[model samples]
Target: MGNIQKITPNFWFDNQAEEAAQFYTSIFDDSEIVKVSRYLNEGQEIHGQSEGAVMTVDFKLNGQKFVALNGGPQFKFNEAISFIVHCATQEEVDYYWDKLSEGGDESAQQCGWLKDKFGVSWQIIPDILPELLSSSDRDKSEKVMKEMLQMKKIDINLLKEVDQA
Candidate 1:
């Protein structure tokens, strides 16, 4: 058998499991759609999905496994849960922020957080963000925090400037 992940995040979509999976795979490297399962006649009454409709999509994004389910509109994504994308450089943060925020809700963006078209929340942050925000120097940390709060996309250079100021 292939390797199995102990825990996997399942994304609920309103009939867009396949589409969401494809979109995510396209944005990240080393990503691919692993399997697609179709709804069957047996569960048609409860699921309300056509027998041939895509029911679930198993995919991997940069080696992390995930499941996208066409589970209808009973639930929606919120900021309470978010995927954090740690980046080593501003270029990486910019790349991920732009790609993930395309077609997403602009009003939902703040402090490096964005909601994708699928309503999934993502945080595109620099690897040094945690360090800067939790520094021993209260003034430097507070300055960095203020700058970060003002940004929709994280600016590594601006955060670093807090140290010199």
Candidate 2:
């Protein structure tokens, strides 16, 4: 495959590269697995993976490119890095939140941020959030900010009502 994207995010997994790629592809529209590569005996001493085992998976989600690597447990994903999903409507927000957060870390959920079962952090935000939070009217912005801080998943209707109030 050609390097169409200048930069691509690579996810390092202990051994779930293919699984995670499949899960992510299933959650988004216009997504699919592009290619998969297996470990070769030449790197057995360094990678410590069995021959022919999954080593990397190339995939696309809604046109965004990503790579998943079976890099072992030397490192792990954290909240410091997260993928943001911007939703145009409440239904869109709800759909992504419910699907991505399944079997995920519930305690990490706050202000529309969640950690999936694979420990990858994600922020599910409304498209109007920036406008609401950055409005010139401090009163409206403050109300939205306060309400947002108290939410695990953003309630667009409540935010809108609070903004109007």
Candidate 3:
């Protein structure tokens, strides 16, 4: 097979690497476990234990490759970086928003920004966002964006109304 493209997001869990992977994959469609590689006898050890348990897990979500690690809790997911998913329709937006926000906090913002239980942030934006933002009318676009910034989970209809005004 050709070189498979992957967007690996390393997670440092205390000991919940596998559980986190299963929980995440189960929440998305077309997602499944790809591979699980535990620590080998020759690998480095942590806390006097050799061969780190659940060293890495390769998984896919909606066809996107992601790798999870059971590294120690030296770091955690923050709001600095987030995944932005462009939805073609309101239905798609709702589906992702609801699913992703199940055990996470929903933030208020134009477009879409939500934080899952894992504290990993995501932006579920509409495909039409670019179109609206790039419109010739800067004032209208700004208005639409401002309106979006104040709400949680983008509403395409509201944005369209703002665009028309």
Predicted model with the maximum lDDT: 2
Clashing pairs in 2: none
In model 3, the runs with Cα more than 4 Å from the true position are: 40-52, 107-111
Residues 18-82, candidate 2: write the lDDT tens digits: 99999999999999999999999997999999999999999999999999999999999999999
Candidate 1, residue 93: the lDDT equals 95
lDDT of 2: 0.97
Taking the tens digit of each residue's C-alpha lDDT, what string does model 3 give over 1-165?
A: 977785466666666778778987987789998999887777364433356467778888888888887766778887788888878999999988888788786542334888877777889999998899888999998998898877788899999999998
Considering TM-score, where higher is better, how would the candidates rank from best to worst? 2, 1, 3
Model 2 TM-score, all chains together: 0.98
User: Which is the winner by lDDT between candidate 1 and candidate 2?
Assistant: 2
Candidate 3: what lDDT?
A: 0.80
Report, for every candidate in turn, its global Cα lDDT versus the true structure: 0.94, 0.97, 0.80
Error of 2 at 123 (Å): 0.5
